[model samples]
Target: MNNYNTIVIGGGPAGLACAVKLHKNNVSCLIIEREQYLGGILKQCIHDGFGLQRFKEKLSGPEYAERFVNEVFELNIPFIVNAFVVSIEKKDGYTINVSTVEGIKTYTCENLVLATGCRERTSKQVEIHGSRPKGVYTAGAVQHLVNVDGVIPCKKCVILGSGDIGLIMARRLTLEGVKVEAVYEIMPNPSGLKRNIYQCLVDYDIPLYLSHTVKRTIGYPNLEAVEVMEVDEKLKPIEGTEKIIECDCLIVSVGLIPENELAGRIGVLSDARAKGARCDLDFETNVEHVYTCGNATHVNDLVDYVSESGEVVADAIRDRNDSERKLIDIEVKGRCAYLVPEMIDVNKKNNKRVMYFRSNKILKNATVTMKVDDKEILRRVYANLRPPEMERIVVDYPELSENSKVVFEIEEAK
Candidate 1:
């Protein structure tokens, strides 16, 4: 059996960042990754637009991941690659069962950080009626084939969903001399960032059809074409709007869900709306001595935020001690989709706590208000709020007395 101060599951950008911070602080940490290499999903994300916020320069996914990987090496943080953590349960601290080639091994840690990241939603999840075809692939799979494996999966393709991955893949296919027929999005607003919409679709002159969706894919052994349909405000397909677009490949990039299998095994309560573990201000889950960060906490729009979250968790882990938390549940109003760190540890000494959230519907000139026990504490005005773009806000808990309650509401600017 091996032991450490903290054992981080999954060696992606988040896990690596956490380990690096802990190592710098002279904390013993181990990172367990199932993949053969570090970097996680960034390995296949060959397109640029990353590291703009973190590095203040445009970098591809691999480049940005390399920065963290290099730091991990410099710090001499130990990591086990190609080792999958199969089970985890409480044992004094926590016992992690890892499945390795040599054999299953056991490791114990005082605290655990889950940075399992996220997984792409497949065609089945989106409920596209079609037979299994060879040409159908997720945006990530296509990206790996094209960038990592050096093989273009398609010469002509129809992309479903306007998320960043799908949009980037559209541009990538276009640059590879492949004909990108169009990108279909069921929602009225594009799911990707505004800049991505412009640079990837509009800048490249690739057609993007809003309020549209893929009805079905027709093919025997491979994809021959995709039937497109317009969706109503409810996102239900409208009859008589079916348009068959002939394409060899159909890449689906609907959405990403936080991978919380490990958390679930340890009885960590997950927030259905956020699709992640319910965490406090310190990013610790309801489960004792267990914490979650990065995409496992929530699906972040930027990978840099993922790294930042890792550092936050690592710092929190450094000061962790068994103590009763003064927890306060956060409530939302006025089209608020969801909020990360669903609760605040009022007992925590940290005055300023970073919180992230999104609005359910498009809001223009809105004001976000935070009230403690029915009294206004924090209020910020925004020009606009969209579900696709997440907003990070800091709330100060300076004047909290006994029986304090925190609630958030978004009101359109008058």
Candidate 2:
């Protein structure tokens, strides 16, 4: 049995960032990753446009993740690669079961940080009714095939959903002599960042069909074509609007959901919208000292935010004391899709909150107001709002008592 002060489960941007921060703070921690190497999904994402916020310069995913991985190596942070955490039981502290090459091992830690990241939504999740064909691939898998494996998954493909991965793959496949028939989006608006829409889709002259979906896939041992159709507001296909597009492959990049099986093992509460653990301001989930960050908390558009969330969890763990936490729930309303950190721990000295939110529908000239006990704390304004682009803001407010209620509402500018 190996014991440590803290256990960080994951070695991607989030997990690596937490280990780096903990090492810098002279804290004893162990990083456990299931993969053979560190730098999770980033190792395969060869495209640029990462680290724009954190580094203030454009970098590839590998380059961005490399910075943190290097820091972990330089500090000689203790980590186990190819280590799968099989079980977690919270006793006096936490007893974690691991399955490594050396066989079963149990590790004990006072605190656990889950930066498990997220999993991409697949064809079945989107209900793509079709035979399991060889030509169907997820955007991430196709990216790995082309960038890392030196093989192209498809020569001519039709991409479903305009998320960043799908958008980037559209350009990548096109550049590799693959013809992208068009991008089909069920929602009225594209789900990816606006910049990707221009640089990846419009720049390549690839067509984008909004309020549309892949009605059916035509393939057998391989994908022959796909039936695209317009969808109504409820996202159901319209009658007689079906059209066939000949393509060898169909790439799906609908969305991502947080991976929280380990958290579930600990009986941690989850937020419905966030699709991950519901954490407080200190990044501490309802499971006491157990913390969560990165995409395991919520799917973030930028990897920079993922790294930041990890660092936040590191600080939270280091300063964790026996003080009682009094939490106040935050109310979301007025067309807001969802808000991270659903509640505030008013008992803690930390008052600065980094909030991330998105609107339920598109809004122009919108205003977001935050108040505690009907007392205004902060107000932010935006010229344009879209569901694809999440809004992040730092809000500092007066410390409150246990009964003080916090509310966040979005509204059109009067």
Instruction: Give model 1's clash tally.
Output: 0
Go through the candidates in order and give the C-alpha RMSD of each one to the true structure.
1.4, 1.3
Candidate 1 residue spans exceeding 4 A from truth: 399-402
lDDT of 1 by residue, 169-203 (tens): 89988999999999999999899888889989999
lDDT of 2 by residue, 1-414 (tens): 378889999999999999999888777999999999899889988889899999999999899989998888899999999999999999869999999999988899998999999999999888777777779888988998898889987778999999999999999999999999999999999999999999999999999999999978888989998998999999889999989999899999999889999899788988997888898887899888899989899888889989988998888888888888787778887978889888777778747778888887789999999988898888878899988888898888797888887889999766
* Residue pairs with backbone overlap in model 2: none
lDDT to native, each model: 0.89, 0.89
Measured against the true structure, the TM-scores of the candidates, in listed sequence, are: 0.97, 0.97
Local distance difference test, candidate 1: 0.89
> How much is the lDDT of residue 351 in candidate 1?
74
- Residue 125 lDDT in model 2? 87
Error of 1 at 160 (Å): 0.9
